[model samples]
Target: MALTLYIDTARWRAHQQSVVQQFPGIVPVCKGNGYGFGHERLADEAARFGSDILAVGTTYEAARIKDFFSGDLLVLTPFRLGEEPVPLPDRAIRSVSSVEGVRGLVGARVVIEVMSTMKRHGISEEDLPKLHAAIEDVRLEGFAIHLPLDRTDGSDAVQEVAGWMDRLNAARLPLHTMFVSHLKADELARLRQQYPQTRFRARIGTRLWLGDHDATQYRGAVLDVTRVTKGDRFGYRQQKAPGDGHLVVVAGGTSHGVGLEAPKTMNGMMPRAKGAARAGLATMNRNLSPFVWAGKQRWFAEPPHMQVSILFVPGDAPAPQVGDELVAHLRHTTTQFDRMLDH
Candidate 1:
């Protein structure tokens, strides 16, 4: 028993098929732990979905994905100067987001990413002419834009995407196709009709693989269990429990993305209150764990180790016996599963 991802293959495949049918031209984004489903598995799934182009994060991933997926591979990150991308078939498309990128990846097939609200990468609208001028010996496949995931204001997405398109067209560059991410269905439909001359390829990741949460489950197998009283000292910190409880050592820790908290995105007052509560707990070095045993989420007995974590389960809660597995709610992109069970 270990950190296992139990997947319902039937429902998973059905969801993938259903999602693909909704979008005419979708470039599946399979990168960064392949959203916890493994890159190779997702590459095969993308190919099985009859996709023609697939987007990966880096050249390191393109090499591996190419082995299993017989489709055009699009590398999302811009290549550095004098950096040699891994040699592969001619189906690879490099993303050139700046003047340097245009100059760096000369004589390569590339997609120019326009800067959206994300602003992490891509060339600015004002610099489109500079990028256009720098495009020599490189084949401009199309334009690319990574939208911010937080843009949930009604039809703002459609307007935002149009703004980029307007800028690109104003530059008088011969761009017709665009690769985009994080747009709603209605926004996409409106954009299609608004710009019939332009082709939009949705670079979908989360909605494609993890849209149906019921199809996937993360479970951590109990490795060790020890009963303790309120006054007993244990763990590396030698801290005593606040009350009588059982120390549940389970598989999956920091190495598997357990107990690692990313900055929370506070939307409104309720979420802010919850964040404040968690912050108060963090100050005491007491954190919560994602594992659920006895029908309740457990707290961390101590900081998570590399491959496993220690969970503190209150005595009043249902205690998990040794070898029992607990369901762990995890961020798929950050987690590394030890086993992938399919049925």
Candidate 2:
């Protein structure tokens, strides 16, 4: 009677163990809906994995999962002045990207983030000296750099990381530890070989929990089924049926992140053209739903409601019974499931 996430528990745990083995010092990231597993669940998993540190997106997230994970919490979002005071300051290692941030979090555990090519956050190289001078009062855990995922611009992530290492060395800053993201296994290995003194811990989220594609499944239970003919009015907006079909009320909707799309990066011309075609179809009320019945994705009768979606299954296709579950292709990061079953 709900949108459920079913997990192959053994396989999922095996994948997590493999990731931990691949990245010797990995910081499991549990933030932003906890990658659809919730903060406490991932925090417990991190504890089970024996991780000494867990990375979260914000101080608020750290506070939420602090009790669940008994290790140090690394807040990836840089702490700024006048922000809400961090909870459990002793166990929280804040990421500081500015001199003011360093000054603001004086006497707190902090990691100084140097700006990378991503340019989202972090202190610039020009201000490295100022950052160096400002970190005297805080417990400087180490440095961190968030790398860009797209490497098509001829810029190598390893080179970028090494460049920062060289700059930090020149600045006479501590080179004991570095936290990095988006580095491949071989790239991390090369960096480790280049700098034997530094311990590089990769902060990973998606690849760690969602690495095994076969280890998870999503299903939406059929709540009701109504046979309809062409021109039959239905749904909240009284939308007419386009053809003979069965209107399926599935137990998933806007509240569960159904019929919602996050902004995507369309790199190639073909992708951009296809995206435009999808948008054009959506404007004409031909939007498709994620629920798959009889091995085909069905069309949405209308926009999803708060707790249910109506899918139009054409007459030719076999319709699901009220108790049957329809397999759904969903983006786990954005989805909020009512229940998770471990098998």
Candidate 3:
């Protein structure tokens, strides 16, 4: 039973070409399980795109991908003081997001990320002086700001960035380069103009790596197909097949980040009943289906388990045989796949 992302080679090549042509000097971000295809493969692909540098999520993540790529690897995760088994990958740039981290990164090439949307890391406006003094012995390579997602109002983004710039200006930090995450080209251009002295690096994962929606597809293979009676029991929960048809088993299940849950918003609408005794009805139908099968856009099944998922392949339509492949909308971060082959 294998769950995989089968890459259409021609489509992938076209995607790469389009990306490179659009964005020059792109830093391919290979992080968080490489968004499904694994870090090393993403690195190899990034090299083909002619990316001068690559960004990894953590120091440990960097170790695995360092050999796969020849370009400079920058670690986005922070380095703590007392965390044992510290990762020190050669030819890698580390991001120091805290005063302590900056102090610890003495003599190391570090990127300072002023994190927005989360107040977890980075040297604050008040603490920058202390950080500067602590890192006086070390060479400060550059500064970076991890941008947040834009809001409906668009004021949070502007305010946070302005505050970050104010802090940087107050500290008089000699920043040679800056890296921004989740920023648009126009937004980045505006920032660059404001801070004309520094070089800006856009650390993109979603756009740079998995840019096009239809460029690549995630498919699951039908391992077993058996006709089950309506009363017959199946699955972990002993769920009986609704109708008399082939019970198609796919290569996805709970262990692969499937069957997991998430939060949702409620509209809180109350329907008014016309003339029957009572008067009002409040219905709460908040069922969430994260995945859909191929061809049938409206039809959807629940998240699959680690290595298997069950989909209702209609008998009226073309039925799949054993070992038949079907498309799956995969949550890339949660899945540990068998392999990905370029077709």
Candidate 4:
């Protein structure tokens, strides 16, 4: 099999429970490589969460789990006016996020995203009136708003949301539901209290799935292990490991999100680099490989390839032989796996 994602089933179940407790009537979102567990698998899990509805990133994503999920499926992406929209399966709900897409979804069950954080779809504030007029017949599941977490207080959030609600209510449009993202609990509570007439739906992904680190881990089987001299030539580029050590080849690489992006910084610091430097100094000035051996980190021989990662497991560490297993932490959305074993 390819790279494997191991989910602590107990922890995942508990996390789901926590999410439901916080936001009752949870609409579990399952989209984009199923966040490394595959779309269909997530759909099945969401079904158990008693969530009869789910949000998907695209039509292709929706197609992946239509059979698995008997509930209403909402496609977040807007289809083009002239382009033939894929026929959503029975009971599927589509989100029309554009002005032009309104008429095309005349008889379809759909939601309309007002303003989205992703910046891809959704009707502009100026043109929303025209779009609302067009969508008079289609059953609007709700008005979707993908909010970004800001440092604002609860009062500020309530005021902003109240203003938005005023505009929606002023349009003389029938509004019932509201789907939001990235909002804090306090803010959501404030909004709920302020607008008791509207049904609130939180479209959470990251904080729901990967929120608990102890619940998730990735693993691959080591295919080979060999001792190498300082100058021993190995790997695709004939790059040397630079030190006497054992070269361990594990089944994971860029194809599984390993060494895929250059680097990403959060808030003003290069988080990856900072973490790396800290670990290097505190540990052994060591670089991390795509694969970890014997509970300790190793160094990659070179940049990762499609499906395999070469690591220089130090000569001193207990080396893993062929068919041995290796483990690593993975960025969910970026990684794809052949199997997701829930323990």
Best by TM-score: 2
Could you give candidate 2's per-residue lDDT for residues 1-343 as a string of tens digits?
Answer: 9999999999999999999999999999998999888898899899998999999999888888887888999998898888877657588999989889999887999998988888888988889888767888999999999999988879889999999999999999998999999999889999999999999999999999999989999999999999999999998889889999899999999999999898999888999999999999999999989999998988899999999999999999887899999989899888999999999
| Pairs with steric clashes in candidate 2 | none
Which candidate wins on lDDT? 2
lDDT value, residue 212 of candidate 4:
87
Arranged by TM-score with the best first, the candidates are 2, 1, 4, 3
Which stretches of model 2 miss by more than 4 angstroms? Answer: none
Best-to-worst ranking by lDDT: 2, 1, 4, 3
Error of 3 at 231 (Å): 2.2
Model 3 scores a C-alpha lDDT of 0.68
lDDT, candidate 1, at 78: 80
**TM-score of model 2 vs. true structure:** 0.98
lDDT of 1 by residue, 1-343 (tens): 6999999999999999888988889889999999999998998888887889899999989998898888899998787777764887789999877788788776889898888888888888778778656876688899888888875564477788899888888888866898889987777889999999999999999999999999999999999999999989998889898789899999998889997667867888999998899889989977889998877788899999999999888888877887999999998988998999998
Q: Candidate 3 lDDT, tens digit per residue, 23-84?
A: 55556789988987788788988888778789998888888888899888888887778766
Show the lowest summed lDDT stretch of 10 residues, model 2: 80-89
Runs in model 1 deviating more than 4 A are 130-133, 152-155
**Collision count for each candidate, in order:** 0, 0, 12, 0
